[model samples]
Target: MCCTNNCINTENPSGNCVKGYGYGKLIDGENIKYINCLEGKCFDQYILVYAENSFKAPQNSLNYSLYYFEIKCKFEREKSSVWMNIGLRNLNTNKYIYYYANNAKIYNEKDEAFNVSINWKNNDYFGCGLVYPPSNMTNKSPYVFFTQNGKEIGEEILLKDNSESYKPFVWLKSLSVEANFGNNLEAKPFKYDISDHLILK
Candidate 1:
């Protein structure tokens, strides 16, 4: 799904919004065009943007017992210390788990951090994947994983809460990022080989 146009903190009539405090403009239906903040000490604020629709996987597939939704994104410009957060947020609970690009860590809704020791640079391709086991597999649990430039990074993190209300989201600061939600593989192929993870029926 494409990003929704209803941006946050973009209604500065005086054109004096603090630098790095507002959402970037969405361009070409998938890319987030960077908006330069006013000249001053950069005010650090994360602009949260959600996709146009929630992701849903096909249910009850015997051969494909695990299902996953992945988002591939490239860091176009890295103008700030803290770059961005890419992950999934539960619509009902409002809880989120994201990969923090600055410190190479993962963070949950409680502000807890998990160190993954993977550094990224400008123009590097990175992404997050949410994998869920089949409903019939009671022993299995849902988890989150990271990928960089067509390769998996770190380990798969299992979620404590098994709710399936999660949706893809991104928190941006002063960064220009291009995201692909795997809506059409032919148009924008994912950097990671997602077909190896789960087969979508």
Candidate 2:
């Protein structure tokens, strides 16, 4: 069995929870169990793994929580100089599960310094991430959407494209975004985890 929200008798490691993430053990082109516990969220930019018994009881426990993370990106050119803030929230329980930050400073096309912060909150369980640039440069912004079972279920757009990234509202399990640019007007789609940072390329 796989470690997921839909698992039955989730009290212990009854299934392959470790494989649910990305760090699967390698053995003869097969995914072997490498970790013993698995209970958390997966953001495209990062992954938060939790303990099996950490999940709150459905009746008396918060059950849901929210987390937060912050990051900064400074490029040699003004084009890449930007800051990003991310959060993971569970509204039902009003708790935070994880929080992080990544601050980057670049010099001469080289990454000079990077700062990161990670933490867990016990308030709510709401999702958050880079919502995208604002809503001013409609033509320059990319298209963002949510997906489930390999199918798109919801969509959102960033009308502004001036900034390199934006703080998202909630944490999404499976998401995909595409950027349309150039004379060809090509569409480039990217798959991301539940993390707060995503590459526009």
Candidate 3:
């Protein structure tokens, strides 16, 4: 049977969408670092960083991790509207620690800069070389609203803060192709809508 669902929109809006994944290798020269995907599940679904690029380094002979990214989300022409929950438990302590990105940069321009942001619903610590926001872990995740030529296009969940409940609603607003590259970026300048069905894991 030929079924046309929410996966068939040329303006690439809702239905007629494709479910695929994208990946990229982030290299800084010879000191490779691996950035894995949390929601995506593909062989190339992880970010691999190896080597070092002195040209893009902060200083000569200094170890700087500034790499461009090429991400292939599972659902193309779609935005996130779910608060998918994830966790990492400490075997020694038997404590489950939840994790989420305040914002994420999915792609970069020809200049090779990051265009992503994150909003924290909560912040907690787990002790793994990872830093947490300064607050309690709330059950709110941010979203992304895509647009072009001043026309609304599509949207997706850019970050997953929790799996319980969200308030007001969060969104990843407008991001310049030439934004700064660093951690702790916040989602800004975008609109937010509620989608009680989507979930990220």
Best by TM-score: 1
Ranking by TM-score: 1, 2, 3
Per-model CA lDDT versus the true structure: 0.64, 0.25, 0.23
Error of 1 at 153 (Å): 1.4
Off by over 4 Å in 3: 1-21, 25-44, 48-77, 81-99, 102-201
Off by over 4 Å in 2: 1-34, 38-140, 159-201
Q: Which has the greatest lDDT?
A: 1
* lDDT score of residue 93 within candidate 1: 80
lDDT of candidate 1 over 55-111, digit per residue (tens): 554477454333334444444334454467788887768888788777888876676
Model 2 residue 57 lDDT score? 14
Q: How far off is residue 105 in model 2, in Å?
A: 32
TM-score of 1: 0.75
Q: Please give the TM-score that candidate 3 achieves against the real structure.
A: 0.16
**Runs with alpha carbons beyond 4 Å of true place in candidate 1:** 1-23, 40-45, 57-59, 63-82, 109-111, 199-201
Candidate 3 local lDDT, 1-201, one digit each (tens): 012343322232222213432222223321122222234643222221111111121222212111221111122212342221122222333333222232333221111223434432221111111112112323332332332222322233233333122111111111001111222235422121212222222
State in Å the error of residue 168, model 3: 32
> What TM-score, computed on C-alpha atoms, does each candidate reach?
0.75, 0.20, 0.16
Please give the lDDT score at residue 129 for candidate 2. Answer: 27
